[model samples]
Structures are given as structure tokens and as C-alpha cells.
Target: MKKISILALMMVFGVVANADTLENVKKQGFMKCGVSTGLTGFAEMGADKKWTGLDVDTCRAVAAAVFGDINKVKIVPLTAKERFTALQSGEIDMLARNTTWTQSRDTSLGVNFAGVNYYDGQGFLVSKKSGIKGAKELDGASVCITAGTTTEMNLADYFKTNNMKYKPISYDTADQVQKGFEAGRCDLITSDASQLYSLRTKMKDPSAYFVLPEIISKEPLGPVVRQGDDVWFNIVKWSLNALVTAEEFGVTQKNVDSLAKSSKNPEIRRLLGVEGKMGENLKLDAKWAYNIIKQIGNYGESFERNVGKGSLLKIGRGVNALWSKGGILYSPPFR
Candidate 1:
């Protein structure tokens, strides 16, 4: 009886120890990443059947860190309603779908937010013809919102706090909300300011819609991972951190190769895996971060290429800039 009990205990410990997600990813030969259905400049499929955007780059960075090849990821597009459920159910390895980090979501859901990739805020988008300059003007106006998202509660709170009332026309996806707004189903649409800009560009006349200046609630959007896998969580978290750190050190894709071999800066050396066990600590190859910088790019490069001045969004760095540049973006030391 004692031998049987000891054998059973050993079996349990074996199962627990073998639950490393990184090992599973390697065995499968590819990483599964969840993205939005089709949010322009965040995650969208182009005419060439390729996914390109800020969120897509996040996925590629993780892939490069693990496989040394960015293309070893399969993009799984998910709606806001389906995203968390998919992660919880193990349908994807990680979620880089521009999801917000909130208290209730962080604690209640069986998932963890890696870190804030985009510091955003909720706002309203109205047509120029409405002659409305602010969100407070629409007391009784019908508002279009995406269902099963934080926007629903934000809209309710904003109206109630101001002693106002409005009709809510909720939809399943951002595209549906955009279609409803364009079809005159609602007087205005409310979403993340960046999303509003993306949606406006899809309109017949992008200049006709104007986003309100009032940013209602704080929405620090980032990637997510399952709850039990601390190893995988650390890998994803630091992969994002590497991007910001690389940019802070001026290590772009164009110069990462030379820097890896010749740069003498302590932080840069640790980051590029030239003088430390940073990669080994994360159970990755020594050239993990070097691969990410060489293949995908640093954070600023991804932002500029996908949604900043280099893209149609033309969004200023604003609060997304580095901490040294008067923004909140700061990475922990590689040491």
C-alpha cells in the first residue's frame, strides 16, 4: 500500500513538472497567436493574405525569441467576445489582440496580462455633420458600441455620472459597429481612440468623422497568457520588454547585428545576449533577443511602421513614447 501511494505521488509530480508551455510550443514547431478579427493598424490581413500590424509584430517577436524565425506563428483572428475564452480554453498559445488590462479582467479571468503595449483611452466618434463638439452633448443620442467589451460599462458610467441618458446599439464586432454607424443606426460610435481613427479611415470620407477630445477611461492594452504557465508568461513578458529596451538603447533592426558584436554598453550587451545569461534565464537561445530585433524590430519601429507617422494613422507618440521622452513606456533592467 505504501509503495502504491508513493508511485501515485511521483506520477502527479511528473505531470505537474511536464506542463511547461515552452516545451509544448517547441514540440509543435510553431506558436499559436490570437489577434483581432480585423482592426486596421492593429491587426489586419492584407491583399497578399498576410497579417501586418502592431499586434502582429508582437506575435512575431515572441516567435523570433523562441524559434529564431518570425514566420513560425499561426495567426488566429478572434473577436472581443471570443478572445479570452479562446485563451482560457487553450485554443491559442498567447493573445496579442489589443486587449485592455483591467482589475476585474486581471483577477477574475484565468489569464494574465503581460504588459501594456499601447496606452489608450476610450472616446467617441461622431460625424462632422452632427455639429457636436463634445461627448456631453449627446445626452439622449443613440450610441453604437461593440458588445462584450469594457466600452459598454464605460458608456453607461459616463452617461450616468453626468445625469444623462442614451440608447445603446451594441454589435458583436468593431466592423459591425462601424457599419451601424455608417448606416445611420446610431448618432455616433464609441471605442478606443486609435480604433476610431482606424474605422474613420475606412469611411467614404474620413474627414467627415471627428473623434471627441474627452478620453473617458484608461485602457492599457497588451498581450495575455494563460494563468498556470509562469515560464511561458515570463517568456512573453520579457519578449515585449526586449522591444522597448532595444529602442531605448538605439538598437534598430538595421544596426542590431553590428551592435551585438561590437557595442560595449552593459544593458545593450545583456539585451543582445553578448555578455550575459539573459536568454538562458528565459529558457531561450543566447541569440533570442538578437533574433527578435533582427527579424521583427524594436518597439518604436513596429509602432511607426504599423500605426505611427510611417502608416496611415499618423498617430503621434503621445503617451506611448519612452519614459525618457516624457512618456510612460519604461522597461525593467535586463540584469
Candidate 2:
């Protein structure tokens, strides 16, 4: 009788230990997501209160994977300073904000960048009327920049190496930086070039501003999750991988269902949740990727909808294009 009781207790502990993120998320009924406060094309709340943008869509894809409904997510809008704190405090399960993946952030911040969803570089935006054609022209110019970001350090280093002197009017948020730049407090606004493009589009006289031709630093922005939870980390990482893999496999939102039923490609079938035990291995239902593709589309689709050809941002897919297409976008094999 004593032996049987011990065995039963051990069995229950084993089951609990093996329970993964999918099970916890389903039990919770909603995936908590950290998003940007309002970056326009990256992560913003719509008029109808629905969250939309590349970062928002990444969260929606994770929700779709777990719940089969993209709407089963709670978006917590976080400022640059608050993003990591919210993730650390468990206020959000995952962060899909426009966060730069850096070595210190990965090692010291107790979070892991799942993958680089957007390849960006830091650059400057100046009024064309100022006759500043490139970053080198900004010598002795006052620059508006955001605090608590790698952009600050990059800006400092770039100007120092060029032997230029400039005053940095650093604000705690991007909105404040934009306002300072617009109010003539600073001669130039510096950030990721993609962000500069988005901010320029929002300016009253967008034609007045021109993004400088120099990209100063590499910015591989992506979703992040708390470290030490391998199950949760893998879910976020592989969900991103699924989107990239889907795009690489020629699987779009429109054709996923048909391809799931009839495509002869083994990889496509596996990615679409048609064959193989991929979903089960991830501790999710077999229709996980199918739901994600059907609901959120692929990475290319999200990029086009939020920032590329379809949106007002109208940024070209330069380094964001697929590896086969001469860009750096590549995903690990799904198998």
C-alpha cells in the first residue's frame, strides 16, 4: 500500500512537470502580449480598439496557435522603458514590441529574443530644407533621440568617431523625441530607419523630411519572452519560425487550406499541420500552424500589410526579403 501511494505521487509530479506552455495558455484563455505604445505601422490600437501592426500580428499568431482564435489575446501597450519590466513582472506573457535584440538584453535582461522578425538599421531623419544630405552633414547639429535604447549609444559612438560635436536632446519616449524634433528643439531625429519612415509619414509636412543615406547600426528587432521557461520560449520562437517557413514554402494565407489538403511537398504539408507530429511536439493541437497561417498569414504578408507596399509607411523590403531572394530573412528547418 505504501509503495503504491509513492508511485501515484511520483506519477502526478511527472505529469505536472511535463505540462508545457500550450496547456498553460489554454487554461488561462488569453495570451498576454506586450506591444509598443503607438509606433503607427509597428504596433498601434485601431479605432475599433483592435490591435494591429507587425508586432500585434505576431501576438495574434501566437494566440491563433494556442486557441485557434487570434482574438484570444490581451494587448498591454508598453513604452520603451516599461517593456522589459512588464515582461519581468509577468504582466505580459510575451513581448512582440519593436524591441532590438542585443547581447546585453539577451544576457542581462532575463529575456530571450526568439528570432529577428524585422531587419532594421539605425539612421537619421532630417528636414530636407536643412540641406543635410547625409549623417556626416550633422556635425555640430543638435539631435533628438530616445533614451534607454541602443540608439543612444550608437549615436554617441558614430558622432565621436567622426570627430563631430552635437547636443543630444534625449527624451524618455519616441513620441517626445518626435515632438522635440518637430518643435525645432533638435536639428535631427535619430532612430531605426524604418521607425524614421513611419514617423515621417505621420508628420504634417512629410515631404519636408528626408531619411539620411547612412545606416549606422544593425537593429534585428523581434519578439521576446522571459528566459528560463524553455517551453514558453520554444513556443514563441517556433511560432515566428513557422511564419518564416510558411513564406519560404510558398504558403500564403489564401492557399494554406488547399495546400494542406493537396500539396505534394512534404515540408509544406508538415508546416500546414497536415502531416507529421509537429504540433504535438510543440504541445499544441495538430491545427496549430494551420490556424496561424489561416488567421495571421505569413511573415511577408504581415510585413506587407503593416509596413511594406500596402501601408502608408511604404518602406521597401530591402534586407527583410527572403534569403533565396538575396535578403537575410531565413528560418531554421521546421523538421
Candidate 3:
């Protein structure tokens, strides 16, 4: 008997490598998504205890792409301390918990961020009773902040760089930070600007507090998946790209079907799976992107409904807007 080379044997035996995150997700029948423990407008349980927000929508979009159904997902709420651990341990397939894409996090952690869903910056939320007018006025003030987060480091750097002093009242979770701040254990609470707005609404009197005008540090928040899995990375990356691209081309959910069938634009056609083999490259159905748009809508739509003017947070698009509109959001072509 003649022995064949490994390549020839594979061709003859019809053996294909069987390892990828997509296969695992398919086999499990649901995408395990990590999210914030409870941060409004990003990922929070509503009155009905059902998860809903911008981050949650990111997970749903991935589910729509993989399973052609947005409902096929399991929400794993993790604190700042637990999010990366859960993703690294395979306890969650991906994380969409408004995590910042920093140099250290991207390089040191065994994870890769997909894209910036929202451009944010650190800001302080000061109670009206404190009469704090700006972040600069918080010298020697006690601040409530979550532990094991970039918040602590940024706070220290900001105060140190400004030649100011502060006393930190730290907790392990964002919820505890909010509780501590509200209970007057701290003079102010600091976090991302958008997050501060969301946390403010949780107050008994939402109007009693306001985020300072100063945005101290840049925080480009987005989704993340474990490193070393290009298949999974592509799926998550393109899923986000599809959303932004759909928004750019005006391929909204209400008109996606018509656009997919009758659009004269080649780019829109490719995005909607009317042309191109993008889904094939990702090992998903030809309509993977179409499912994401049809089910979850585009990035703009999700932002508007979850954290933008339409939501309780009422945050402005600002830097989160598309590149054409002067913001930095740019997505790769579908084809």
C-alpha cells in the first residue's frame, strides 16, 4: 500500500479541520454573551428583568448573524472584575459590556476588541447638594469609583496631572459605587460620561446630579472576543462593520428587504448578501449580515434606541457619529 502525504490524505479522505468558535456556537445552539452587571443604556435588566441596551444589541446582532435569529443568546452579566475572566475562561463566547479599548487592554489581555460602538470620556457626576461646578473643583474630594477598572487609574492620573488631590472610595462593582456615592460616602462619582448619565437616572431624583463638563480621558468602548480565534474575530468584527455599514448606506431594518432585492448600489447589495461571499468566508449563511440588520437594525438605530435621544439616557451621538458626519466611525467594505 502506498502512503500519501498529509495533504493528499486529507483530500482523499475528505477530512477538513473542525475547530472554530462559530462551530462551537452552533453546537451550543446559543451565543454566551458577557455584559455589564447592570449599566443603563449599555447593558441593564429592565423592570421585567429582561436584558436590553446597546451592548445587549451587539450580542443580539452576533446571534442574528450566527443563528439567523436574534433571540438565540444567553446573557452573562459580569462585573468589571469578572468580565475578562469569563471571556478568557470560555465561560462566555464574547463580551459586549462597553469595555474600553485601551493600549494595555488590547496588548496585554488575551482578547481583541471588535470596534468602537461609542466614543466616551471620563467625567464626574456631582450631586447638586455638593455644589461642585466642574471636575477641577473636586480637589481633595472623596470620589466613589469601581475597583479593578481603568477608572481608578484614570482618576489617579487626572488628579495627579492636574496637581490636585482626591480620596478614593472604591468598591468592587459599579452598582456599589453608585450606592456609595448616593449614600454620601463620597463627594463625587466618576466614570465614563455616558455611564455617568445612565447612573444618574438610577437616582431617586435624576435631576439632582449632573456630569461635569470636562471629559478628562478618552474612552472608546466596544465589544471584545478572545484572542487566537480569527474565525470568531471575523464574525464579531464584521458583524459590527455590517451594522455601521448598513447605517452608512441607509440600509435600515424597515427597508433592508427592498434594498437587498432592488438596490442599484453594489455596496448595499453586497452588504445585504445579494452579492458577495462574505458569509461563506465567515462560515455562515449568505444572509448573515442581512439577518443582523433586519433583526437588530443598524448601529445608528441601536444607538438611538438604546442610549441616544430615544432612550432614557438621552445621550448625544457626538463622537459616536459616523465618519461622514465628522465622527470617527468607519467600517470596512462588505465585499
Task: Provide the TM-score for each candidate, comma-separated.
Answer: 0.94, 0.92, 0.93
RMSD of each: 5.3, 7.2, 7.2
lDDT leader: 1
| After superposition, candidate 2 runs with Cα above 4 Å error | 1-23
The segments of candidate 3 whose C-alpha lies over 4 angstroms from its true place after superposition are 1-19
Cα deviation of 249, candidate 3, in Å: 0.3
Clash pairs, model 1 backbone: none
Q: Candidate 3 local accuracy as lDDT? A: 0.88
lDDT of each: 0.91, 0.86, 0.88
User: lDDT: which is higher, 1 or 2?
Assistant: 1
Ranking by lDDT: 1, 3, 2
Position 132, candidate 3: lDDT: 78
Number of backbone collisions per candidate, in order? Answer: 0, 0, 0
Alpha carbon lDDT of residue 8, candidate 3?
41
Best by TM-score: 1
